[model samples]
Target chain A: MKTLVSYDIVEDKVRRKVFEACKDYGLTNVQYSLFFGDMTHNRREELFQRLRRIIGRQEGKVLICPVCDKDLRLSKAIEVSAGMPEEAAEAAVSYPGRSRKKARAG
Target chain B: MKTLVSYDIVEDKVRRKVFEACKDYGLTNVQYSLFFGDMTHNRREELFQRLRRIIGRQEGKVLICPVCDKDLRLSKAIEVSAGMPEEAAEAAVSYPGRSRKKARAG
Candidate 1:
């Protein structure tokens, strides 16, 4: 099944350990504290136990959710990555006020 | 369809606007930067456009994902909330070292 793991951890050290655990399972990091990947049922359970032990007695909440096929089909993604070098060049080219500002500076 | 929206926004003001927008759409906050809920296709599209405009030209990346049913059924959630008052009392009761430290202080 395709699994989605998300967590809220209070301690910095413990949180980092949890993050590393997710990565070790080959899950793709989707957001700051969210990861997505496919794992068998047995593996998922094993991971659950490992994560539980890692967060023992700490203020943390970890959720590992299995997503459905219909929902996956109906889902969508939107990404806006700003400040790329190419985009920066394009932005510089589009701005007409740059030369004016430079002339004033000189 | 159930939608899962996750974002990485660099600006505080812009990020907050995006966060508020997600909640406005009635999506439940799942993590620090992730939200989940069910919405129609048209509505998801609408949110996409709104989010794009909100993050316009800013250093941001937003993803809206659709999950499947089988995955959801197979998923698991683990929560470890530490430092609750009841747990604190339990810890104090269990740890004999705490009293030793107190005695040393005296």
Candidate 2:
């Protein structure tokens, strides 16, 4: 299964620490802090447990969610994977509508 | 009602265009390209439609995902919100374990 883990870290120090942790989990960098990766369902729970411990040590907090249908390999991953093209395609359409409103608001 | 929208845009031109759309939608900046904001369930479907139209014009593709709880305010939001702290706390612990393993693997 492919997991897109999005984490929220308050401190820059914490972000760096969390980034390292994500890299350890074999997740590829999609943005500055977000990650996309492949992990079996069984492995995901275990991975989440380990990530939790790291945050506990740093005195910081984070929210890690298992996002759906992200390309873990970044550019390459997007091309080869057909696990859920429909969902990704749907997002393509849904994303801009909100964006247009947001631009007008600001 | 809070929505976390994550978009994957292949082209930089497309990302910029999409970013504006997201800003227009009243979503706050949480990262370089990710957004966290509040929207009623009723508003969500409408928002998606608008975004799709925008993407169609761009000749690019994107993936917008409504992620789970992320404090849109960035800092103080985390404090005031008690809607889901346990999940965040759990992530704190889980993030690290995976990090440790990744460090070893690398």
Candidate 3:
């Protein structure tokens, strides 16, 4: 899993301390305010704990996003609408009708 | 799922046409390049098909991201490192070792 961690520190010293703590855990730096690499599930648990301690009460934030290279395919209907498939009468009704009748008053 | 549809058109006419086509399918516009609202699985399928037809060969991009309110929690070890739990000596060894013994070459 690829995780994105972002942080903002008030004092420059605190940021350095955070990086030192992360380096101690062997998490490779990826981008500005982001870290990429690997570790066992157990190690990750330990690392997170250590990180929380290092941050203390300073304002910080983190976002972990999963990365995938899958390419989504359009369905047959999609292809047809794109002019590759024959148009069928049934496909017309699939569109939602606008301006439905208002609810009857008691 | 919140779908983001971003398109770049060479001519203003093409951009207007795309919007007209989207409005025909009942997709409510959200941001400058985003659309959000309740859409049935089947409707989504039909919409994608029509969209392909409208765009033809124009350069465009779309990203569909699932929206949720779930908040991720740090594990117990993470809490401990934060100073909320007792420290275990075994946890000290969880950090990844930086240096390893060189492999002996025959």
The digit string of per-residue lDDT tens for model 1 on A10-88 reads: 8999899989998989898876787878877787788877887787777777767765545544444444455555454
Ranking according to lDDT, highest score first: 1, 2, 3
What does candidate 1's lDDT look like per residue over B14-89, in tens digits?
Answer: 9899999999999998667878787778888789778867876777667676654445444555444555665442
The runs of at least 3 residues in candidate 2 whose Cα sits more than 4 Å from the true structure, single-residue gaps closed, are A57-61, A67-106, B1-4, B7-63, B66-106
lDDT, candidate 3, B1-106, per-residue tens: 3222323334466557766765675666532333434455566666665665555554333233222222112212111122322333223222111112221110
Q: Pick the candidate with the highest DockQ.
A: 1
CAPRI class of candidate 2? incorrect
Q: What share of the true interface contacts does candidate 1 keep?
A: 0.70
Candidate 3 lands at a TM-score of 0.33
lDDT of 1 at A28: 86
Off by over 4 Å in 3: A64-106, B1-106
Candidate 2 residue lDDT tens string, A26-102? 88876555676677655666666565555553444344445433211111111112343655444332222234444
Q: Every prediction's TM-score for the first chain?
A: 0.74, 0.53, 0.51
Sort order, TM-score high to low:
1, 2, 3
